[model samples]
Target: MIYLDSAATSLQKPPAVARACSYAISHYASPGRGGHKPAMDAAAAAFACREAAARLFQVPKPEQVVFTNNATHGLNIAIKALVRPGGTVVISGYEHNAVTRPLHAIPDVTVRVAAGQLFRPEETVEAFRKALTPEVTAAVFTHVSNVFGMILPIQELARLCRERGVPFILDASQSAGCLPVHLEELGAAFIAMPGHKGLYGPQGTGLLLCGQTPPPLLEGGTGSESIRQEMPDFLPDRLEAGTHNIAGVAGLLEGLRFVEKQGVQSIGSHERALTVQMGEALAQLPGVEVFRSKDPSQQAGVLSFRVSGMDCEELGEALGRRDIALRSGLHCAPLAHRTAGTLETGTVRASVSAFNVPQEIPRFVRELRQILSEKP
Candidate 1:
């Protein structure tokens, strides 16, 4: 199948990722709990994965990186750790429901929303500057919107937040491995990302990287201190609780290795080139209208559009019948669609991968044109 849902989750991960996971399962052992060889081996593997993630994300200390089940859990930890009750939080309109719902659930939290599609670097900086009252403790936004692949000016916003002493948090599920991120350069306090997405790892793997000073989200057994009932107030052990996703972590480590070898810019350029080709082709097709960031520099690997006179669901199904996989509806970013003027019916989202080739774009566009011309 010609899979076009990489933004949702990448398929056909690097061979090393699968191999690492299989090794984890076959040579099973509990990490940080046992003294045997198997346990030691498992622990070593887990630590290596953490170190790899830390190195990739540019965290100073390996222990500062906390592994979560997925980006949702990581986001929850980030929101809970920084956003106290009765504090103001600013979130972009482009955030995923993973971020928006969690912020909404925080009692006494006041959310100030801004335009998702129209947000440029300068506007984002201004928003942070205007919202940095003493009462505003934190701000959350996405580096890239999963809906239309719009890339926000995160570094500029991060700098603004740094100056104002407001903790800047990023939900980077769509941009993690697809874009370059150095924790030091961005100056963000918290970053939540799914390892499965651009990281090319298996599902159920995710991580949260925090600045030099980060709050603890959960208190539990760290295996280092079984004697303490309360959680330790330090680094990853302070946040990561219970058994970890060892298999998934194994896969993620290999994924990082693959990315490191291939280079992030290369992956990003490849994905963008493919998306641009697809978007241009789609725009040229009859009865098709594409929704994308006008500026190519401000977009990611995803593209959303609609065919005139066809429901989104029908178009997605039609595309699927032709061996193409695409996502329809809100894409967990209703606010983004609202900003893009596509919320009422949603749009058909085609998210390309670094692995997608040049030939696939023309084929996808030709099939789309054919499908749109047919009667429902």
Candidate 2:
């Protein structure tokens, strides 16, 4: 099977990740739950994973990194803490439901989309600058579009938010391990990411790096200050409640090690090369419409496209029957589909990963062409 949907979850993980998880399951215990040897070892293992995450993302403090169930869990905590009632929050047009739905749930919160033409970062920054009014309490931006893989100018947007004294929250779900993310350099109030995507960890593992401590999303045992009725005011313990996912974090540590050794720049270059090759081939095929950045440099590994005569679901099903894994439909980002003019007929998305090879692109294109050639 050829897996092409790394954006949803990385199906190809390093062998070390699996090994680490297996080892943890048998030997590790719940972190911070007890003072015994297994519990202490588990706590230490979790802390080491936190440190690894902090180093990879350039987070200033290790404790500032809090683990969550997934990117959505982390995003919810950041949004709920930063966005003020009746205040405006500026976001990119390409944000997933993870960002949009949370904002919608907030009472009296005004959402202003900084709409930008696909692959045009300058226009995106300009639109955001114009929308930064005094009434804006916070600004949230996705580092890259999951649908189109168009990279947003996050540094410029961060600077603009700083100038306006608005707290900057970054959704790095698609960009975390795929691109270089310097938390200190970006100066974002919060950055959320999933361990299962670019990080190559198992599902149900995520991290939220805090520039400033936010209020705890849940109140419960943090394995610290058990007697106190209030949640601890410390860094990670304040946000991380309940038992830790020791096995998941153990796998995440190995994944982080693999990424650090391979380097993000190298991984990104490889993925983008595959995307370019696949996108170019698809564009040349009859009746195929590719949705991506015109400039190859402005895109990541994700490519969205559609065949003229076929529905996206039909095409996806055809490809699936041949053991090709990709995503179809709106991709949980309707705003992105609207921006790309694919709202009515959702596009098929093929996102590459480091494990994917150049040879796979031609095979995929050939299969897609054959599928499209068939009469409905």
Candidate 3:
């Protein structure tokens, strides 16, 4: 099967990731649970993963990194901690439900959407500037759109938030291991990402890097403050509740190692080249509308498009029959579809990964053209 949906979850993980998980399952115990050798070894492995993540993201301290189930979980914790009651919260139009749903749950908080023109960075910045009034208590945005791969001007937005004294929260779910994310340079209040995407880890692992200590989302045994009912005041322990996902962390450690060794810039260049090829080919196809940047360098590895006579779901089914894996429909970002004027008919998303080859691109295009030419 040709897998092209890396944006959903990286199906092609490094061999070391699986190996580490297998080893941890047999030999390791719960971290910080006991002083036994097994537990101690597990604790060390978990801490090493934290340190590796810190170094990769340019985080100032290792302890500030908190592990969670996925990017959605991390975003919930960050949004809950940063957003003030009865205040305005600014966000981009391309945010997933992970960012929008949490804000919806908060009472009396007004959400202002800064919807820029699709693939236009200058318009996005202007929209953000207009929405970031003094009443806005915090700003949350995605570094790259999951639906269109539109790269937002995060550095400029960060600078604007800094000048306005608004806490900036970034959702790096799509851009974490695929692009260069310097936490120190961005100066965001909280950065949330999943290990399963570009990091090439298992699906259950994620990270949230905090600039300041936020209130705990879940309170339970952190193994540090057993005597007290209240959660610990420290970083990871404060947010981390219950037993650690030792096997998941072990796999994530290996994944981070792979990313570091490969280098983000090199990986990004390779992915962008694939994106350019796919986008250009799709645009040239008769009756195909590709939703992405005219300049492919400004985009990531995602390409969303639709055929003139075919429903997105029908096209996806046809591709699936051919053993081609890709995503179709709204892609969990309706606001993005609305911005791109594709709300009525969602686009077919073909996302590439490092494991994908240039040979697959032409085959995919050929098959897609055949599918589109068929009578409904």
- How do the residues 227-344 of candidate 3 rate in per-residue lDDT, one tens digit apiece? 9989999999999999988999999999999999999988888889999989888888889988878787789999899988789998898999998999999999988888888999
- Write one digit per residue (lDDT tens) for candidate 2, span 177-256: 87999899988999999999999999999999999999999999888999999999999999988888999999999999
- What are the lDDT figures for the candidates, one per model? 0.83, 0.92, 0.92
Cα lDDT of model 3 overall? 0.92
Predicted structure 1, TM vs. truth:
0.96
Query: Candidate 1, after superposition: displacement of residue 249 in Å?
Result: 0.8
Q: Is candidate 1 or candidate 2 better by lDDT?
A: 2
TM-score of 3: 0.99
Q: Provide TM-scores for the models.
A: 0.96, 0.99, 0.99
lDDT of 2: 0.92
Better candidate by lDDT, 1 or 3: 3
